[model samples]
Target chain A: MNTERLTEPSKDELASGLRRLGAMDPGPDFAARVMGRIGTAAPLPAPKRRMARVIGWLMEPRTIRVSPLGSLAAAACLLLALGLFLKINPGAESGRTPAGLSPVTFVLAAPSAREVAVIGSFNGWKAAGWTMRNDPATGLWTLTTALPPGSHEYVFLVDGTTPVTDAAAALNVDDGFGSRNSVLLVKNGDGTAL
Target chain B: MDKPDNDRDDAMAVERTLSGEREAFAVLVRRYQGPVYRLMLRFSRDEHEACEMAQDAFVRAYERLASYDQRRRFFTWLYTLALNLARDRARRVAREPLYRQDLDMTLADPGRDPLASLEAARLLDALRDLSPKYAEALALRYIEDMPLDAVAETLGVSMSGAKMRVHRALHMLRELYGKEGKQ
Candidate 1:
């Protein structure tokens, strides 16, 4: 391989060489194979417009005809039955871990913050239920909760107003608003990150 | 035909396909299949994988047709999708040993000099050593013979950015080839 002398090839030579490299034939049946695969695959579902969804919801028939005393009695019975069920299944009442959910600790260090919450695709970007607790000693807010094993994009809300990304996150994606959101990849029960 | 005419034809095809004529997409497939396959082949260096990726790219284009902006050229959009797919495939097969296709066998001219063929192969090998962005920029510019503006459009960069990428890529290629020569 005596390619030493040919190291500094002219620009035209490089262009011609690249042109040669890119000239492979893709064979005759290429289009046919692609069309065949398309025929076998399922067609994409029609996208529903917002107006259609609203119309569908509005058109759905509902019946509500109950006496006030009967409604109150039914509500009371439902509450008593829920209390009995909770008494029997204490773990369910205590919010026991669902199957296939791995515990992931979300930490944000905001010393001066009054409140901090983690919001992401997993929780519909809701800050109400996924609030973090602050540690007086380290001033680091932490929340350890079970998230389904997958990649999740999250942002930390400081004091219920400011949105901040976790600096410790390994991956980040644009939030489409000139800001970035951190990404967390939770491994499965077998310790495999997907 | 002129470039604008080609772009108009592509836009018309997209309009027809979006209007429920699925066969209109075939027009697009036929028009771009060669260049898309060539781009994928440059990335994977495997004929079979390139074909699969090209087909997959067309299928994806059809599926995501609604998302396609009519203002852009169809081939540029399609080429970008194919490039991303090829990059993903390359990443998955990164650990596998690379099998370089023999460039000499596919030449149309039998009387071509063997030494030139060897040199071409060495240049391609040096190209493979460059980063994907740089190599892709160079390939789209030189191999596909795309204009700087088209290259910029395909790469989602400004014309000046595309020019810078090509310059940097060529510089890297020169360094790589020079080092290989010394070895």
Candidate 2:
């Protein structure tokens, strides 16, 4: 029972009993029964004769909504693919990495930033020797780091001051500074697992 | 448990179900069956009909998943859809619901007070006879234990409108109940 209620029902047995009635369950196997007959009838929008149309709409392709961040991420993936095509490995991607390391690429769309650095647990959280290159052609900041197969925490330092976490990160945690830090898991022998 | 959390999970389920994962729709059916079934019982106290109506509601929702507005709470949209189905079924099928029989069976317990059950039954009878709008307001507010904003959302009305409907319904129910007392 919630002690701090936002609204009060009538203070009477009828209302109280009605509240108690809310506990009633629909009974077991209810979900199983519903699932057994979902596809029997066509939707009101689609008549039976238009089965091919339904299949066409169901199989329709969708496009990504382009945004600044989205464009930067796409550019990063393209750049990574190109790097792989040419077998290009920017050496010393990060300060320290274990044996059998993979180069991981990170990107941020900070067009106005004068400088950007990659700071994370990988390089002792310091913004030294981990500077990301700025692509003036696209205004996207990017860095490729070679790391072994393991989990890592990282954040982008825009203009060497403010920290920005990747919005598309699979997981993130509180940075204890009223902000978030992104987590990245490097897959098997893949460089720039952005 | 929180509204935002439920909304996020439901949005994901809706997305997955839309993207050819038929099993994701089952997760939604399992999550909301109890509430949908209870609401159906308000329209027809028969357990079998309530279950059927609930199943129909989920199927209809699955068919219309594309039309669901992401702005509204998924449960609110589902409850409103179920309510509309119940109303549509009532109009199509002319049959009196077995309210008293189901109530007796529900309230029959060894340690339960017989008098309390009788009063509950009488109140439910008045509830059934009440106008559909008022009856629905009471059911959503009390039986569903929904907050005022959620009740408003489910009823497709404003906050004051929900409050007015609930209070008026309560007043009508009390008068009808007093008549039951006299009899």
Candidate 3:
């Protein structure tokens, strides 16, 4: 650390001098030049209607109808059909993965951690809604979540602040912000990782 | 207009500009052109480049006007945009030598007091030597005479972080100025 000497200007003097340094005259034509360019330049495009606003409006319920028994029956049939389909056509089940999604299990041994979450390109780098559950006895935190297939970079956020990369991951990439993120290649369920 | 009216007027200009009144943007440009150009000059250290960068900043602000949060001070957003532009320009021109012997010849006015000019030049040189973060904080807090909260908003830092940067920058500047005086 560089220490200030007694001979140096006091902070107040420096501040006052800086303030008095004043704005440089950008010339008499500055504003006119700016206005001219703005006049000639293309106008801003109108903003696109946001999908989130539409979704929010759609999510508001106007009414509710109860059909518990019928809904339960339909749900049971759907589950049975899904199970049979998975059993009979394992390859098809994997191929049918929704929009390149695949199940992945992330495990971390953190004895001191109270809470952990996963953040990555898959979740738009957000730390919410992807929390991991911890086993108190083994002191192991685990998260099983579906991620889009292909190379996805992620980090384990510990206690909502510390970003820890997985040591077990053989692949890692620089996040371009002075941090490394663990890279995971989700397979297409064809026994080959992308 | 008084200070509060001027601020409210700036916001009103933004609203008008966004509502297809293209001429209203000129009001904002005129209002802020001085500080914006000066801020750029602090980073670029060249008057022409500063002018161009200030123009670029205003153009960008106009293009991204819809994203501006009206609750915040308009200059904060504009200053932040100009600083980012300056940083990008600095990075792109990092390989090139910034200081030129002829700079004084081109910039200095013969009629002006030589002593004041020399002092200003020395001050600018010292500022250039400081870290970019420190330079930016000092420029915003002192040169622009922004309130601490406004400085924090412009730099995307906390109020305390802004304060620390200003304090550290002043200390660094003092030390650098002293060393220069010795020579």
Candidate 4:
């Protein structure tokens, strides 16, 4: 531990310095000023609507809090998480998606590619009909598919040859090979845009 | 992540918060707001910006509550968020670096009303002259009387790093005091 040598200032000197530093007062109504901002700040209008607010509130990080109920919820969540983690194949395994359904669109900017397939937790990482075609004139590859509504990790197999990742998505999971696969977490029964 | 009783308390709080118990969060805000505000004030030169950043940090923390690791102290996480926001604000304003300073009067005027106590005002001014990092370290370590490990966690630095910051800050403070004494 890098403890500082507490300089032995004369008592009078130290007391005077301490008194000087201690005078800066907390602003009156400091707490009120802080609390006033609770729900008033106008978020991006488009994302401030009722549904978005609800989704954001539910998925919001601060809601988890550091309180008694929060701890219980956290414990339950941890247990649930542990259960889910343990139930899943813990070993080196092929991509096996859980049972559910979520609609996802895979986009690739490979104008030069003839094909692109998605392989991830959704379809056992298989290269099949998941390959998408470029709208040759537009130079962008696009494929929309129904994935189970949950956290599904996926990536594009460009030209059925090169595996490419999504740049625009928010969540991503590492794909063991020093690369990452884009993750789309579709909340259960919510068609909200991430 | 302390004892079972504490864990129970945390869990109960978590449940209330998740159940949309607004006051539960308020309880948390009231509890940790002072530390968070002070930390921000150390980072941002102005009280208004510090208040704004601290508020933003709380809002952001509230939004990210579900991801809160229950084992950790809420204040530590909130401090990290507040510090990050202050850093972001600093970057946007193209402010001086954290540990480097021009020793300007950027701090003498914290707001309209000056501190009522003369001695405290001098100390506050001296503190303000230090770099944000050093000032924050000193405030957290000395003013707040936080333990070394807690200070480290709040500052998001290793224990050794936190100690170094505090050490350097105090050394500078002593120097500033020496200059004042000479004067």
Question: If scored against the real structure, what TM-score would every candidate get?
Answer: 0.56, 0.53, 0.58, 0.45
Model 1 chain B weakest 10-residue run by lDDT: B99-108
Scored by DockQ, the top model is 3
Better of 1 and 4 by DockQ: 1
A61 Cα displacement, candidate 4 (Å): 27
Give stretches of model 2 more than 4 Å off.
A1-11, A39-194, B95-102, B106-120
The digit string of per-residue lDDT tens for model 3 on B11-117 reads 99999888888889988988898888887777775777778989989888988888887888898788778878888888988623345453464247676666665
Stretches of model 1 off by over 4 angstroms after superposition: A1-6, A40-194, B95-118, B181-183
Q: B1-183, model 2: which lDDT tens digit per residue?
A: 888888899999988887778788889998888889887776775657778899999999989887787787889889889989989998887757445667677545556687766655556666777888998888889988888888888888999999999999887776666665666
TM-score of 2: 0.53
* TM-score of the second chain for every model: 0.82, 0.85, 0.86, 0.71
Q: Model 1 — TM-score against the truth? A: 0.56
Q: Label model 4 with its docking quality class.
A: incorrect
Best lDDT among the predictions, by candidate number: 3
Instruction: Evaluate chain B of model 4: give its TM-score.
Output: 0.71
Residue-by-residue lDDT tens digits, candidate 4, B1-183: 444554466556655776667556666676666677766666665556667777788777766676676677666666767778877877787544322132233234455344333334445556767888887887777776677887898777999999999888787877775565455
Residue range A54-172, candidate 3, lDDT tens digits: 88679887786659998899899999999998777644643544655676778899989999998998898898888988999999988766676688889999999999999888798
Which residue pairs in candidate 3 collide?
A: none
Name the candidate, 1 or 3, with the larger lDDT value: 3
